[model samples]
Target: MDQHVKTLAHLFLDGEEDKALHFTEELLNEYSLMSFYEAIITPAMYYIGELWETNQISVADEHLATAICDFVISQIKGKETVRSGNDQSSGRALFFGMEEEQHYIGLKMVSESFKAHGYQVRYLGPNLSLEHSLIQINKFKPEVIGLSAALSYRLPGLKEIIKRFSELEWKPLIMIGGRMARKFALEELEADQVMIVKDLHHLSKWFEEGREGLINETS
Candidate 1:
């Protein structure tokens, strides 16, 4: 990383909100928004989580760190495209959850990662009904759709939702990931892709590979 980015990461790790925000904005001005997300914010978030896990930071501190990180991300404006441009007709995805699954941190990170990789993201907020999900897919017409299932109990509902999508003429590349995805076996969910993301690197690689395959096929 460059000097400015290294400083920004330290500020975030030290929980210095004001300094970090200023640094992030400067980085945004100097680099592509996607670069800031993929290279800066994503990695810093991983560091914060690791710090918390090792008891080096308090829960309150971790929460504050995430809030500050989110604040910086929210301030970012402009094209907001990842490796791709603003062609909604191309490289599209809908990321959301099965009904009753409430955790959103992982989903939010996944959404941001997808956007950073140039995929046009239609992020459906948590607890979306099957009807609402179908509506968004029909409207966006994305190439891929992902559902978050954080709870084991909601797997049946998730399966039904996947089944409905499969039945559609415009069936997307369906994928599932989260705690439930990790705790359970892949054969159980029966998704086209069953993923358990341990960090942003894994998430980034997955999207890049998926997008490359799509491009190759289209080419």
Candidate 2:
């Protein structure tokens, strides 16, 4: 583990919002936005999760850390400009955590990644129901939809959500992500229009290369 990541994790666990924000700002000077997310914030949050899982930290402690991390992410995003030069017409995307899935920090990072790449984004945060999701999908008519789940038990719900999304008339590209995505093969979910993106780096690569045919396939 990087020393800086450890320090940031400490700050998060201690609920030191100002210190965490300042430290992250220093890191931003040294790293690109995506790099800071992938190399630093992601790992620190993972460490926090591990501690919670092992009962080293209380649930309240975990929540405090998560809140601080969320604050830091928002601060970073506020300071940065969207770098994607793509036309907004071809770049609409919507992201949300699955129903009952409350872990949305990763989802936020994914949304920011898309935003940085110039995608017009609607990030609905965590625990959004399917009916509301459908409403937004109909209104926004995104070219892509991103869904996230952290726990394994959310698989059934994830499948149902994907099935409903696949049935949509517009047939937007569907992306599955979060910890479960990294741990599972999810081969059954991959199809002509659905993809499992394990991390932001993979997502970035897709934006650069793999997205050519996929985004326009339904059109």
Candidate 3:
């Protein structure tokens, strides 16, 4: 993990896109997808975010790093694999980033993760209106509705969206993630059936626990 972390940090921070891509591919060849995401991709991005927070790096640097990581994740996710457990998928889902929230890589990763698990995942990237999101949800009729907001300022918007979703007569399971997700408790939000997911591991664990759908059912 340390070796991969250093490699990712060097490649990503130095603006070496081709090198970064090659390095990521090499890691994928040598390790599991989850290992690459958890050990290299996720941790590296978190460090980059922290660097921006502490003024160690410029916003442009952070954005570039994120874009590169985004490309790498998408590349890995596009690879074919033989899934082992249930022959059937867990369920369909619609994912989006909240209004004016531009940090969307995390949500993108979630989309890829769902797709890996054979879920019909619809990823509407970044800064979508509630009304627009609702339209997709209605159209998709997904079993899960996912929301991500990296900015704390978007919490009110997130709250409003979740509240409106809760009022729906036939609501899907709602999952929210991002840095701000850790700031507030669920009870404070006054919404049941709403889950706060911190990372891909937690999201997959939710699937394994049979919370999202019948993932453990026989093939």
Candidate 4:
């Protein structure tokens, strides 16, 4: 796509962690945190996924790229202060990958996005079991619960998880995201309590336009 994204993708695929981090820092100077995620890093990782899907890269290569990307995200996050106007009282949010779903870079990005906007976030990373997730949900009692899945096969499990979460009396908002959310028509999963966040850009709009009202409704 864009030159920066292509170069960043190359860096990730090459497993140049230091170079990738430097490139990411340069991008941060040009883009806001959310925009950097939406426009640059996201597209680069998607390109890496395309390479893997088309057999242009080995599974080990793909994992290397993912590891580099993860390192870059962590480096950037470590250096930045929270955005000035955000309120820590925004509310609590818990994020995790669906059972058996191991792709969690997108989930990590989503958690950081929420943190940038000042939400209290618990990012449990990938492949958390339903029983464990419910235990955290019951204890955290977050206003929003975000789940991710990258593969199509996880759809049935995703639906089942949503169903169980819906039955909770507090009725936390359920947010579905990741590659599956973008590639498939997930409108069937959307209801008064469920939302499909297609990308970081969409999530930013939700924070700006809908977050407060939805949090109040859940509260």
TM-score per candidate: 0.63, 0.90, 0.84, 0.91
lDDT string for model 3 (1-219, tens) is: 487786797678787878888888788777666556756777788788788899999988888888778777777785523543435677898899888888887788788877777788899999999999889888888888888877666677788888888776677878888767655554455344677776667676665677734222211
Per-residue error for 135 in candidate 2, Å, reads 0.9
Q: Which regions of candidate 2 are displaced past 4 Å? A: 82-90, 213-219
Q: Rank all candidate structures by their TM-score, best first, as comma-separated numbers.
A: 4, 2, 3, 1
Which order, best to worst by lDDT? 4, 2, 3, 1
Estimate, for each residue in 172-193, the C-alpha lDDT of model 1 and write its tens digit. 7776776776667645444343
Stretches of model 3 off by over 4 angstroms after superposition: 29-31, 80-88, 190-192, 212-219
Highest lDDT: give the candidate number: 4
Predicted candidate 3, C-alpha RMSD: 4.1
lDDT of 4: 0.86
Worst 10 residues of 1 by lDDT: 190-199
Candidate 3: clashing pairs of residues: none
**Candidate 4, residue 208: lDDT:** 74
Decide which is better by lDDT, 2 or 3. Answer: 2
Better candidate number, 1 or 4, judged by TM-score: 4
lDDT of 2 at 62: 97
Residues 1-219, candidate 4: write the lDDT tens digits.
Answer: 899999999999998999999888887888888889899989998899999999999999999999999999887873444544664457899999987788888899888887776778999999999999999999999999999988888788899999999999999989999989899988888888888888888887787778656434433
